[model samples]
Target: MKKYLVLLVVPMLFALGCKEKKTETQPDQIMVTEKPKLPETVLDSLKNHPPEGMVWIPGGEFMQGAVPQDKQAMDHEKPQHPVKVDGFFMDITEVTNAEFAKFVKETGYVTVAERAIDWEEMKKQLPEGTQKPADSILQPGSLRFKKTKSSVPNLYDFSQWWEWSIGTNWKHPQGPDSNLDGKENFPVVHVCYEDALAYCQWANRRLPTEAEWEYAARGKQKNTIYFWGDDRSKLAQEANTWEGEFPVYNTKVDGFEGTAPVKSYPSNGFGLYDMAGNVWEFTQDWYNVDYYKELAAKNTIAMNPQGASQAYNPQNPYLQEKIIKGGSFLCSDSYCSSFRVSARMGTSPDSSAEHVGFRTVADPEMIME
Candidate 1:
């Protein structure tokens, strides 16, 4: 009996020793953690191209518009409330011809104006009773810059900056005669809202939301007035806005009468340029004066909500315009006072003007889970 018990104990001990030896031979395996892979476009944007005239805004919340309850406010600015935004990257300057060209070459996408309009589609868009202009006169085309005025009564209307020219498009800005030769540095004009969208889509970017745009234009400061703060007095050297007597004679005090090169002036606190003046920028949101009230009520954070489901403003009888911000080189205190951080305007999506241009925005996080 004693010998059998000894044998059993010996074997158990041997097995325990073998297990311990095996454990010693293989220590716990180490796991290496890694970050999630980002989309290729997002990674590319991070690589150094050097922002020409732009800034990185770590977006957050801020009071939007003015509350009528507040002593200092306007009818349009009333019912102010907090608006939150996600972080985004915005161009410091309006998109130049050189930048748009890069997008075109990479994507081979034609802008809306560049495409020949389908007569059937045009007819469908027109009001039921409206007569189609004869083919001889019905030159289906897009907006173009006109140094000379047309007989249209609304041509000089600061709001109406477009002229329908047959050959007009981004490449033929003033018509086929005009080219991108010397105007590479100039803000690319004659681009409709759809044109801007196509470029953004190809670049894997988007137009800034109106809320995001205002937040960025305001820079780091909160509740302060202008992008450069509350000072409206025309300082000797400051932002590129209308100076001296507007329209009739711009003193060119700001080194430019028309559009200046991006970053020609000092940058705002967030390092963005031309936030106040240069050319009015396109925003993703549609335009409606009461739209702000709706957004405030709903606390919407949608990147792009179709504006107003329906038109409310009589100024836009046909409701063709969407929101545009930051005023333009043509903005004046005597006329249109949209140079302020909070000011906004809208125009026809199909229209373009010398005062209108756009910048692109990149998503901080391009992908979603």
Candidate 2:
């Protein structure tokens, strides 16, 4: 079987509102119940605008996940259902190389891709008696995508173009030979979930919950396909996505072959940029193909659903994966049609790629502080 890894890695390396009602009974009785004072946190949220580089997403109900009519919708995205999320602040764009560098500088943090592999941990997910790869192969590195010479029918054989390159990390996204010298504004790729979480902690923000992410990406629009609208034509002008055949060819019609600079394209209705294509973003949710089914079965709006309590991918049950939202520049109509607002994907928490990155979200309470 051509593992999903190939199709997955080949890409590059690879809000709420409230209303009040009047009571009918006590016109003459003059009954007055103090409207619950907006909590200080809520008041602070309303009084103060979102922090620099963040946008406030008003809370509300929306249909989250692939619509029934979307031909590109996958099994995991099925049974589109309603989800309610509270208002929160989200980064205006993906964390950039410069921003991540600053975090590393301030905290002396090393990304998972830059750290040596743990053989003990690796063996846990493998069958018994499986021998460890050579120490050279276990060195710190990440997956990087290389273009194929010609189009191939099978996009899943990611090994064809993805190399487990040594010295490839967020700072050197392409490989050991590459550097971010002039690409500080580009989204920082090759960051694992733990790396992203560490940055979030230093920044005092957190990953957006899957529901919060979908709700914000919808941008208060009702059941739209792409973040801008249902029109695919807008993608060429509004988002950075593959313009021609993916993997083998890219026309760069969108003015970018890989990741584009932050805010290179227009912002969505919520004033958030690159929510469609650019790079896939990490979400505070575990991967579970049937998670949506479980939520849909509730037959009621899921309020701030935190996602599956644990990671589960039936196809790769031993590997724990987390949900990744948005799509990357490698996303094209021909393959990985994940730029759709409701499209979803997942990968192991420890995995990193040239086409994956993340942004942060802050709760009202955090923002208040």
Candidate 3:
């Protein structure tokens, strides 16, 4: 449930064939395409998800984040405060290929990754007269994670977890060698922020807000060290995480070394599964560092709190990353203990990875009405 904070976007220069610098189009590019409207019957199909993957957490009060002056806590997680939310339902499981395929088939919709790059849009990123059709879905370009040697000083190399691979998309992960074949049960990966948003639209739902997501993930707790309370030893048995060494060797101690199928473990009090370990879920918020400070300063629990300005999924620079919660099977105690409910990470709206996935939540206003 933790979110990565430093996933903000950075400016870069790209010249197609020209020598001058050019700025890329904004991340939220407007692209028009035809899509099938959902019929009432089709829209009703999602009414029933397996109970094992989801649970209802009645809305109320809970202390959010670690207590100040606690022996173990981060600055961002400080100033533990009370948060109140209305009732809502969340998927018991991370969205799977089967579910996403159902949405695609019913809507005749293609994902952002599935769409060919707009040459016109790409042109805007290039110096004048330097634009050309460089790549397409006909060809491929995706954010891929690659392990590399220490390019920076040996002590400051966080480059071990990511690489920008061209063909490593949702359909063909790990480059050409990968296929969706038998992995349909695995949570869909390589999706950008817009891709997850599109899926929610098709499903008649929306991404949870960071507060809502944390409230649900925590089930019901007040300043507990974790979703299950403060005990890392207990975590070893309940969830999937990296074991053995740091990055290179995964012992699969939790019986899973990579992405595991949804509902691979017991559900939380709210009956939601995979909220702690699996692929991280996206939240509908813009991230900001002083966001909490701003919230507290306004004498408000949250003043329309969103995420930051720009966050990049290490795999892709074209998209701006947002907040993604709940670490994956790849997270480790030594590297990323983000499996806790308050843990966090950031990702680009247009970038996808083998370890990123999401679920849907109903609009509370509509439900209440």
Candidate 4:
């Protein structure tokens, strides 16, 4: 979904949303296997009880990055390497609207989408010689999926599905007209990386590092495609994603057309919900397309690997991005099949979109401090 949450520092401000960078890679059907159960943990006798609504994930070493058999794997996901992480507590599900509202109520924090766009600051992330747009286009807004009437020219143009809508934010997911009326239980969307970090600061929690996110997503199932193992057959019934033609119609086979409520599906081996699909969860890693290769070259297990030191996206070198794990409702086999555990994307630290959200984690040491 790297492109699904794509943040193009477009000279055209009217357009928001991302288009997957076209790839020759094809996804062949993978082998089927049973979803694993959570391994026994020492939580029962531990003094560090998981923070409320959080689960303690006892860390262990595992082969990180994509396996060769993952036909859907991208260049960035390749060159499997070794990694280990410290055990920590993670949010059982993506941060829900209700939970985020509590943060907003207490901190009175306004998300990036709610703020007026600044041309002076925005141009810094754009290409030189790019003309500044009109005042109306610089108003508060966020990206929302706008379904096409029928198949478009091709999927390469992400603008076909993602639309930059004014008055869109966490409170108003779709646009100014939409509200969180009955959707408080749904995972909060239209939250950018900066917005997520703000919430983390307020809550005294932090976003999981890229290594931790992938490790927890695996749920003890190593060398497998998803947290539920490599059973691609059961993916539709297990994760909330587009069941029909993407950017056009959704069959709603997953019981919801858009974002489904948390716990709507079975949890992963670590008792984590929506680890596969829902909304893209932000991680602490800076975006580096070759970070995996760099780690693999070490020939030694990366202990608590904190992402790349600097942000780099050859596609969009102007804007800085952070790693985003888990695919969103827009994900599909025909499109960006990023629901797999290893699937990762990068989006602007300041951009917000409908299909993007985040969760939080806490290091055990932080709790003691």
Model 1, range 83-191, lDDT digits (tens) per residue?
6665666887789989888888888877665665555665443334444444653453454433323333432343234355666666776676778787788788767
Q: Estimate each model's TM-score.
A: 0.73, 0.88, 0.74, 0.88
The runs of at least 3 residues in candidate 3 whose Cα sits more than 4 Å from the true structure, single-residue gaps closed, are 1-54, 68-72, 117-139, 146-158, 303-320, 364-369
Better model by lDDT: candidate 1 vs candidate 4: 4
After superposition on all C-alphas, the RMSD of every candidate to the true structure, in Å, is 24.4, 10.5, 8.3, 7.6
For candidate 4, give the lDDT.
Answer: 0.79
Over all chains combined, what TM-score does candidate 1 have? 0.73
What is the RMSD, in Å, between candidate 2 and the native fold over all Cα?
A: 10.5
Q: Model 1 Cα displacement at 298 (Å)? A: 5.7
| Model 3, span 31-135: residue lDDT tens | 112223334453344334323444455566566665443454555655665566655567778888878878778887765655555655544433354424324
lDDT at 37, model 3: 36
Instruction: Evaluate all candidate structures by whole-model CA lDDT and list the values in order.
Output: 0.62, 0.79, 0.60, 0.79
Off by more than 4 A, model 4 = 1-48
Which residues of candidate 2, in runs, are more than 4 Å off?
Answer: 1-48
Considering summed lDDT, which 10 consecutive residues are worst modelled in model 1? Answer: 20-29
lDDT, candidate 2, residue 31? 16
TM-score of 3: 0.74
- Residue-level lDDT of model 4, residues 102-210, one tens digit each, is 9999999988888866677666655455665566666788887889999876886777778777798899887898899999899999888888989999888999988
